[model samples]
Target: MAQSGRTNSVSISHRSTLFVIPKWYNSATFPKDIMRDNISRREGLLMHNKMLFVRPDKPITSVKNNSIRYSGWTYVGSANLSESAWGRLVLDRATTKPKLNCRNWECGVVIPIRHNDEEKSSYIPSTRGITTSVAESGGGNTSAGSDDGSRVASVFEPTVPVPMKVPAQRYHGRDRPFFYMED
Candidate 1:
């Protein structure tokens, strides 16, 4: 599929709906023009089809009958639709998600990466930054809690030490402050 040497042609039939995915494509393997042509063949065309979910969105499962006419739900996952037919990689009865360009939270958030009107993302950032957690608050060098659940500080680290004791006032019946506000 190298651009230097590639033929833009493939056979298709009106029989079964083509479940297109990258089978064999790589930098050294598929050149620019060739990759473009191949992608144009399926991915590009499918992308233009509004009825189909483009990008990483994939079916979760397939329930096939005991016949050759059709099968079950053809579930898809994070394998990224490589140009290879790895139906075996499809994990049955497994907990998974259709690979997303962003995360679950970032899903549907729109982004303006291009000048054209067509180049708009379906998702938008809910906040000013991509700070997932306090640890990720500082440019990622500051990691979240450790595997053992130890704390990791961020730019907004506590200014005062926790469990600070307020000045105690003498009272008739209290030596320690009442833990509950109701009393």
Candidate 2:
């Protein structure tokens, strides 16, 4: 879900929720103003009376170098949320694992979901440079149109990388780090 476009506005509805993984790409396609407008409109206004989740702290790095829209249990892999990629998942009745019938090569990481991990799932990074107020206030970009009307264009705001503090020991036992989300 690139922040500069209106594609996501279609997928949201009363019965469903949309969680947008954030991005830091500076291309014109993902402008900061549009991103702010989106956060304000979809998240701030509490669209659907509170369903959309847009947390810029959770930056998603994709193989295509873009942000992706994620929902619950369904994993769309590296593919877009299109029919071909999402329509083929079948549950293995015995093992309870999801099986996919793919039309092309794709990649995804599957992690077992635990319903009780609310603390970790809801921990929004407050120290990160960007905040909900920043996104809602149109932090540093010029927005040309109203939220009800089509956005003419948006300017990209360059972001400085925040350094991370090292812990005494690794949190995850594995060599690589992983992120987990719950609904």
Candidate 3:
């Protein structure tokens, strides 16, 4: 979910959490008011631009007494969080109707992390730059067990090394996020 406003003005409910991941630059020379606001309000973290990983602590289960549950999800692509990239609903001037107006060509894939009913384990979807595991002792080692001794496994092995720092960094007071048109 995205919003265009100050961080303090937005109120997130207890049932939902928000994560804001913005682009990172090497020189760290641009003005990053957005990142600074997010950090001041404790609303966001810095992550890689090429990849996104979302692992919920608790799985979302079905409400109809079914065994199905969703562990997590991942999004990888070229779409940035913008109206032109994701499209915006606008009223058509000629037709008096509402339509989605997108100015840019963007594409992305959202892969859902599924819970394996047959194996009774959580299947974490692996990506190019993220290390995902559910180890037995909660250590960094890759294993096929959860902290509670339940079986857990990766659906696919991570093919590439992580490009950025693990456990994404928070913006300090002096830190700044890069802007493309900054002069």
Per-model lDDT: 0.21, 0.30, 0.41
lDDT for each residue of candidate 3 in 1-183, tens digit (9 for 90 to 100): 222122334343211122222444443763332231112113433232544444444566868746777555566689765565778998999999999987788778777666546534444433222333211212233333323212222321142223332222334544333334434
Lowest lDDT block of 10, candidate 3: 33-42
Candidate with the larger lDDT of 1 and 3: 3
The parts of candidate 2 lying over 4 Å away from their true place are 1-78, 93-96, 106-183
Residue 54, model 2: lDDT of 23
Q: What overall lDDT, based on C-alpha atoms, would model 1 receive against the true structure? A: 0.21
TM-score of each: 0.14, 0.20, 0.42
lDDT of 2 by residue, 78-182 (tens): 654344644678898888999876676556644212222333344334333332322333333224421211111111111211111111111122211111132
Q: Could you tell me how far off, in angstroms, the CA of residue 145 lies in candidate 3 after the best superposition? A: 22
Best TM-score among the predictions, by candidate number: 3
Higher-lDDT candidate among 1 and 2?
2
Off by over 4 Å in 3: 1-49, 55-57, 62-65, 91-98, 115-163
